[model samples]
Target chain A: MTVTTPRGFRAAGVAAGLKSSGKPDVALVVNDGPSDVAAAVFTTNRCKANPVLWSEQVMADRSARAVVLNSGGANCYTGPAGFQTTHASAELVAQQLGFGAIDVVVCSTGLIGETLDRDALNAGIEAAAAKLSADGGVSAAEAIMTTDTHSKQVVREGRGYTIGGMAKGAGMLAPALATMLVVVTTDAAIDAETADRALRTATRETFDRLDSDGCMSTNDTVLLMCSGASGETPDADEFTSLLTEACHDLAQQLLRDAEGSEHDIEIQVVNAATEDDALVVGRAIARSNLFKTAVYGKDPNWGRILAAVGTTDAVFEPSALDVAFNGVWICRGGEPGEPRDTVDLSGREVTVTVDLKAGRQSATIWTNDLTHAYVHENSAYST
Target chain B: MTVTTPRGFRAAGVAAGLKSSGKPDVALVVNDGPSDVAAAVFTTNRCKANPVLWSEQVMADRSARAVVLNSGGANCYTGPAGFQTTHASAELVAQQLGFGAIDVVVCSTGLIGETLDRDALNAGIEAAAAKLSADGGVSAAEAIMTTDTHSKQVVREGRGYTIGGMAKGAGMLAPALATMLVVVTTDAAIDAETADRALRTATRETFDRLDSDGCMSTNDTVLLMCSGASGETPDADEFTSLLTEACHDLAQQLLRDAEGSEHDIEIQVVNAATEDDALVVGRAIARSNLFKTAVYGKDPNWGRILAAVGTTDAVFEPSALDVAFNGVWICRGGEPGEPRDTVDLSGREVTVTVDLKAGRQSATIWTNDLTHAYVHENSAYST
Candidate 1:
């Protein structure tokens, strides 16, 4: 169980002939709730998909009872007909679950600018509804994959309630949010306002810091739902922590299963003037192709790191910067500190730490090295 | 002749032991001017190289008589010692040319954070001075190359004066200013103010628009020197146009010889609300990894282009955007217009045109496709 790990939730996944490989490509999650409260975040990109447009309206009131997701066509830039398809899919889910059509959310992933198979989606909705079960979380997780190699799922038990989630994404991963679709469910007693605030805070600290690539997608979305079936009204702070942990787990799984990534890098920025400054600095370094390639070759080229740092406007004296790879300080006080040969990078995970020595603020961004496999996978993805 | 194609200039290149390959690593260009007037532009990156710091001060007085460039070490982020080495190199050139040390400019490239060989540089300056000649421009161009496959040189003749220049840069190229070292010389009769205005205007329209890899360097510099060898003062507009043509010529050479690039892409954005908006939108699309990789694979994926456009805040309606590959209109009014297979990309140069339909302003940016060779070259660059 993933999304259904909590009580008062049911899900189902079914093949829709939407994917060329004949894989399951449609899923539905329903909140069988004592109370229905919902919150969601969408891609900030202006070119949103049709499903995103439909769901943004349903999530406006912070109350959604069901979510329908399909992973074959993005249904973006397909004109008004695509929007109508999304609206009809949500209506189909609402009718089967005995909920208002306005209480249904929708999401789509895969090639943009293509029209979804309306008949296949309609048949898939009926079949998925007929097979809805409390133990269908794993199937639901598997239905939302495009380039991802595996399903991502996580669960965190709180003091009295439980938080669980599933996510799917691979190639176009970056900040503000990973290029992903995520659904989180909880049995904790919470209000709509609390759910909205907690979800925003949790995502900002976790999902928004992973910059696998610097590309933002048109269909990225995350949804959080509350069933309130546990009858345990935990403090909002405690619930937020559990939600953050669950999202973090799912994000890590996405990173590990990212397409063609050989090395995972953590860029930790410390001692900046403010939290925003740290984040800005870390993101700049994380996106540097020269620095990323250096990490791929296991070359401790501290000069490239400093060069990347110099491109940002974050507050820090150039002569006061310090950089370390792993546990060895290769550069200190803006000068060479140790021989670069002393540092070893013969592992899959690399940690680059930068100390700005400006103040007491810090942030960490996760990235991957630029490798031949990455180039090959992305270059040949669409075909 | 490159820099020496114009009158009143002498150049020399010498094999300095600073390079492990025993290639010509030190270069000198002297303005044996009746009127010594100069103007320069430095990298906007805050983390600048030591030589850039020195050249910025020398070009401040607009009267530099000589320039010394070395290519075996970047001499950046090496602390006070690096600055001292740059000062020493300029002083050696001044001493050899019988001028004040403040009248000399300097530049360096190659691996960063490594100390320059002081003994080798001191001896190389003496050798370069002894061999300085009017036909040494080819050697000077070759000496400044790091990973560039060939030398870049150009000459443009106005009605009464001639302008010649050479530039060197390959991988870490972007703008504000292209990350490269450039030196231009002219025999026109011009004042310091006119030289400054002409150089700025020319570069702003040419080199500032080429964004090869979206990585800004810490050591980029462009310099223009004027000598009143031709006693004819041409109109400022004529001089600016000639200089722009010369810079554009050399910038194209850099693009052709860019490291590990298989395809050169020109992104032209037409009909924007303002020039800046056009540039912003063009750059956002040009720097997108998804769009670049698609081009590398020879796939006519217009959806990636629209996704990149959607990430920018530039003025454009999602439903009003149009995109074309080569001459085939693949997307019109934000929907599929023609078959993607109709567009062919079998050549090294590809053009992508976008019509925003918001206003009348336009801009263009040149970039390279993300390829396997780029990944391999950059990954092992410092190792």
Candidate 2:
């Protein structure tokens, strides 16, 4: 199941020599709806890419007809010429689809500080527009991948509607967003305000919690579009829950397929004074290179975990904290407890639970261990 | 040169079965002074080691007779018993030196979450006191090393006095201090207040600006002890400058020997609205794993550098930023400028200069590249 699983949506992917590999590098998704509604979130990074600068304007009116994304060139930090490229790409898509250029959103991923071949991108967009179909969602998901090992897609059913999503990200994943491009499509009768609220809530609980690495990217974007073809006005809470579930599923897929990652570690910080405190502690542990490498080594090194936790201002007594690895309490009251050898970390999945001993609030952050492969993959090439 | 290089200071390093390899694991530096004035800085991390917790109290009175340090066990997170070990070590050193236990400072570094062998540590301290000599500086420096490949020592001559310092740290180097133990001795006639102010000023400009791997330790300590034996009370400014110079030399040595590092990167953020803004931006870039890996790859990837700069709230227009690798202006006005191929990163040293174009303030941070050896060394075994 993919974005096209929702009704009144068409998507297509094509190659136009934009990538040296000659692979599919351009994707287009169009919403033919009785009511066109859209919402989006972008990277908090101040260095916005040219396409992000363009798409933020298109989303200002809370309505969009289509989204075009490409890989192989991010078109960021390329000055005025880069802005012109993004403008012309949106204009070409609008002209072909009989819509105003202001209603077209664009996204790009790959090398930054480089320009895209205008003719190649235009030809790919033209070909994608001609091939748009209900069954083309998979190709669209594949087209936007840069270093992802596989395409990620998820679908969920609401009361009487459907929600579908696709995402691509392999590295540079951190809080406030990762180096990801996500698109969610729905076949429900929802207003733009409801769509915006649901999208923010869903992402806040899902995509924002996946911190594969401590690096944030400059071109992260997540877009949600609604088409009222299903003729079902689902409850707002019900729609939001399903949307969150879909996003969570896609986030897990991205985490599992993160570049060169061997172990997927989930850090759960519980009993904090506030949800924000829990998140702060969890993220601190998630971003610790020492703790990540210890996990990769399969060593139950609770010391590194506490060292990371100590770096945060979250409410917790250093002497009263507790830590568990795979359900074994390796550290209790901030001292050695159960034998560390009792904890096994050979599997691909690892869980680190921390008790802040402050309150009842809690949060969880997903991260990957630092492995040799990760360093090799990151240092051997540019992405 | 080391702490013993200063007149009126005696140092010794000895082994007493504390280390499995039988390498020296304990060191003692005694200040025989007309004035026993002392000032120190400990790790800002809340989860401090037992020795740091004890030494913080020792420095509260701004006076110390001697400093005793050990390697092989950090003596952190070991509960009350760890605290007892630290107190006992200080007591033994005080007893042998015929001083009050409260006047002795203790420091430890190595594995965390474990207790040191008290008997072995006590025996080593006894032997160190018996063997104390003026030329023991090199051996004392060697005794405090954990992952350090070699000892780091520096000597500076002021107007009429000499300052000698020794530091030990290889990994977990970050702002506010690293997993380092440093002791600075001077035979100048300075008061406790001057020592405190100069120590803070010197460390802030040197050790506090190094973010080797962005991991702060729980046992970091930097102690400055004045003997007042040289009988020359130089200008405070002159003393601070010399102390800063010595710390800078030691900081550079630590950077060059960072665990598994292949490149030493110096990030300079200039023209910020405030010095704090410059520091925040510089530290952000220094901690960016993508930028570090790019440097390791020797691919003048200016985009990664810009991405890191974009994450900071420091005053600057993203479109007006400029970046340089070494001396090559690879990105100017946020666009490609000089050809990147003209830049050379084959050397061990790399300088990344970012002009924020916000104001007149500037700051610099030192970091190391992320390499496969870093991952291997960090993951292959527990430290």
Candidate 3:
């Protein structure tokens, strides 16, 4: 299941030599809709990519008919020329689809600050438009991958509507409204208001909970397009749940495929004074290099975990905190508990639970361990 | 020249069996002064070691006769027993020197959340006291090291005054007046107010600017003691300059000897709206994992640098930013300039300069590349 699983959507992917590896690097998704309702979230980073800045304008009217993405270079910090490139790409897509240029959305991901191969991208867009089909979702997903080892696609069916989505991100992942490029399609007869509400809520709980490397990207974008192909309209709450589920499914895939990560960690901060406190504390622990490295070593170093949490301004007694790695409690009341060696962390998934014991609120943050592979991949990413 | 280079000070270091390697793990610095005025700064991290908590009280009175330090275990989060251990260590030093226990400062650094070897430290205190000498600064400096490859010592001689200091920190360095354990002994005839003012000002521009791993240490302590042995009083501004020089010398040494780092990086944020803005932007770039990893790979990834600076709330026009690596302008006015491959990073030191063009203020932050060794050493640190 992928973006095309939803009715009234067509997708295509093509290789135009933008990637040195000669892999598919351009993807196109179109909404053949009775209603072109759309919403998008962009990177909070101030240094917005050219495409990001362009897409912001496209989504300002809350309507779009197409999305074009390429994964070879992030046209960020490329000055005026980069913005013009994005504009030209959108106009080209609009011309091929016989739609208004303002309705075409564009997303780009790869190394930042480099000018994209405009000719390759232009040819790829024409090729993708020519091959557009309802079953091209998988190819579209594959084309958006950079360091991702696999394509991420998900679909959820409600009573009379369906939500489908795809995501591509491996590193420079952190939290906000977005982390990477994600496209969701739905045929639920939702309006722009409903789509915006559902997408924001969905991303906050799913994509925004993953802090893989604590690095924010300039090209992060999440777009939601409603084609309204389903004759029966779904309830707002029901549609939101379906969208959230689809996003969560794709987020899990992204976490699993995160580059150079040996362990996918779930940091649960429980019993915090508030939900924000829980999330903040969880994020702090998730971003700690010391804590991540300890997890990579498969060492139940809960001390590093507590030390990380201690850096947060969360409401908790230093002597009342408890930490557990996997299922073994390694720290209780801020002191040593069970023998650390007794805990097993040989698996790919590790759970670190922290009990602040300050209140009943809780939150969970997903992260990847800092490993040699992580260093290697990031260090040589552009090379 | 080190802590003992200043007149009216005696220092010693001895093996305490606290370290598994059986190296010198305990150090003592005494102020044989007509004036025992002192000042200090502790870790800004909320999760402070017991020794830091104890030393804060010692500095509150603005008078101290000695400072005792032991490396191997950071007595943090060890509950009441940890505080007792710190108190006992200070009392032991005071008893050996025949002074008030309240007049003794204590500093501990090593693995966090573990009970230190109290007996070993006590014995080491006795041994160090017996060996105290005017030429024991080097030994004291060597003893305070945890993962440091060498002792960090510096002495700055001024007109009728001299400032000597020693620092030990190989990792978990960040800002807020302190980053590691530093003891500065000055023969300048300065009062307690002068000592406190000079220490804060010096550290703010020196130790506070070194952000090795963005991990703030729980045991970071910087202490300055004035013995008033150089009977000739020096100008307050002149003594501050000398103290700042000594601190900068030690800070540079810490950067060079940072644990597992391959390159020492200097990030200068120029033309900021304020000094604080410059420091924040510099620190943001310095703490970026993607940027650090790119440095380790010897790749001039200016986009990562801009992306990092974008995360801060600094005042700057995104399109007007300029970034240079190793004196080669790779990005000018937010666009590509010189070829990235033209930059050379074959040396141990690398410099990244960013011109924000927001104002006239500027700041520089020192960091280290994120290498495999850094991840490995930190991963297996406790084990």
Candidate 4:
């Protein structure tokens, strides 16, 4: 029954009273043996949450024994009072779990600027500690979610190594709501620098390409910990591959969980003059609300697509352009190709291919369709 | 009673069978003059409408005597067939108005695709020709509106000179949703190059700065025509001032027309490292949906402001930042400064100031708040 994807680690999740829905909202995970070799990436947003700030400093030391995460409140922009609240929360978790306060990472997600009920957080931490078990990974994954309809978790085993991770976010997710927090545990006997490099490279391709509504969050981080329990350590290539698979698996899940989303868009740009130009055009279309909504309504409104790409200063020849939506050639050789009614859009996934017809460079961007659910979830959800 | 602020121009608007609502959706204005002077600019979007493509080529010859505009449909991306439709529309206007087809410019707003009713359009052209008058400017203004609750007309008169214009677009509009088409007529004598330079500079600062929601349309244009009938032309400096005044006036009208737009936002960036950086930062913040919705809710949420700014690579010390929402210093010197609840936000306009505190550079980006009406209008509308 143990769900521990990595050796030398145990985790737990418990009802923290932090979420008004009475759902499990607090999780604690630990590297029980050997040194907890870790490397972390933090959100680049200047307006950071207290947990991010605390974790940023602690992460500079490149090691951690435990991480405590709670959903339902993002203790951010609360100034000195909020930071102290974060410090106290971490201290309480570390004291209960027999880990040093500096070695304990803390995270909170939900409303911003609200004070954390210290009594409730304390009880939650104690309960999580008491409930810690090898089979508690799923419970921990269930706890750290906000506005997400499902849990996002990924596990991989390769080269005598195991990699497991969990993530949470839907909107306020751009390269850097890329404010995603993920916990990756491995017993691969890997070095901290290796883990950091693999994680950054994988994240740049996966999470960084998700431009859902183009809003960056203040509390985003991806923490990877290597317990170094496995005696067999793979080479750089093998280790990087293992970490990338884990990151990719989680990235797809994040796209699937996009709030009230019906369509997942994968925009591929090919034959561009440069990779930079391809991405510029791809992201421009991905960030376009009109284009997303048009696709949502099953309207092959290719004009909006052309209009979006046209706004960019990139060197694209309108006459040389060819565009296809959902495999239907809408625009070819710079003119209308066929009626949109002929385009089949019964699939949940849509592929928009743009041939810049320039010099063969290419890139892809992923996003979700704009829907009423997205607006409702963002506008009405008080959090 | 003469609303024609510019001398020597006969302007009028008449209903064409374009809008199903029975509202006036077509307008025509003639620059009858002792001197025919003209210059124009079109949307930078590469995927342009038929009118824009036709007019850009026409303006290269620097000659246009009368302009016809339709609001019920935008002839964009109709392909070669669409190109023929524009040609037919212009030929009829030219024949009836006693000018060559090259002398007449046509603009269409409303839905895209579908063909124009040729017979109705021909008749509408004749009707507008018969009704053309110097005193008919008001009715002409009324005829050009679509989704705009008011007719935007502005008259700027200086010492022996004048600049008058009519425009359409809601205040909270982005470049995409707002297919801004403006026609300005003046009695001042100026060269085509001068007119083009003045118009480009003025539009860059005035219309381009209004980058709310970052929506760029296929048929955005500003047409300037000089009749030179008053036989009085100002000095170079004086003419520039008159043009600025006219642009300022029209800009106000456009903002006033913004859809269900409750608050007008002016985001001023100062002390940036570079002008480009200033523009990039201002535009980034303006395009941010979360910050926009927060302003709509009157929350004065400064953290969202900082988060938006952080997404840009424009160099700034997060700890050295300062922000004021509606003139209230919410974040001072990079941390929460004072409670912004005391700030008055009931006014129709709001200004957010961000100081990079890096160098001597500043810019102001005008935008509109994200209201429920905006969502409703954009969502419910079929086009």
Worst 10 residues of 4 chain B by lDDT: B169-178
Against the hidden true structure, what lDDT does model 1 obtain? 0.86
What DockQ class does candidate 2 belong to? Answer: medium
DockQ for the candidates, in order = 0.64, 0.64, 0.60, 0.42
Q: Is candidate 1 or candidate 3 better by DockQ?
A: 1
Q: Supply the DockQ value of model 2.
A: 0.64
Give the proportion of true interface contacts each model preserves, from 0 to 1.
Answer: 0.80, 0.77, 0.76, 0.37
Candidate 4, residue B191: the lDDT equals 76
lDDT of 4 by residue, B188-285 (tens): 88777778778877787788888756778888888988888767867767776677778777887787668777888899999999987888899989
**Most lDDT-accurate candidate:** 2
In Å, residue B158's CA in model 3 sits off its true spot by 1.8
Model 3, backbone clash pairs (residues 3+ apart or across chains), number: 0
* CAPRI class of candidate 3: medium
User: Pick by TM-score: which candidate is best?
Assistant: 2
Q: Write the per-residue lDDT of candidate 3 for residues B1-383, one digit (tens) a residue.
A: 89999899999999999988999999999999988999998887777778888888887889999999988888887888999999999999999999988999999877777788889899999999999999999999999887777888888888887889999886443211123889999888888888899899999999999988777677888999999999968888888888888899988988888766789999998999999999999998888888888899998888888888899999998889999998999999988989988999989999999999999999999999999988877777666
Q: At residue A19, what lDDT does model 4 achieve?
A: 89
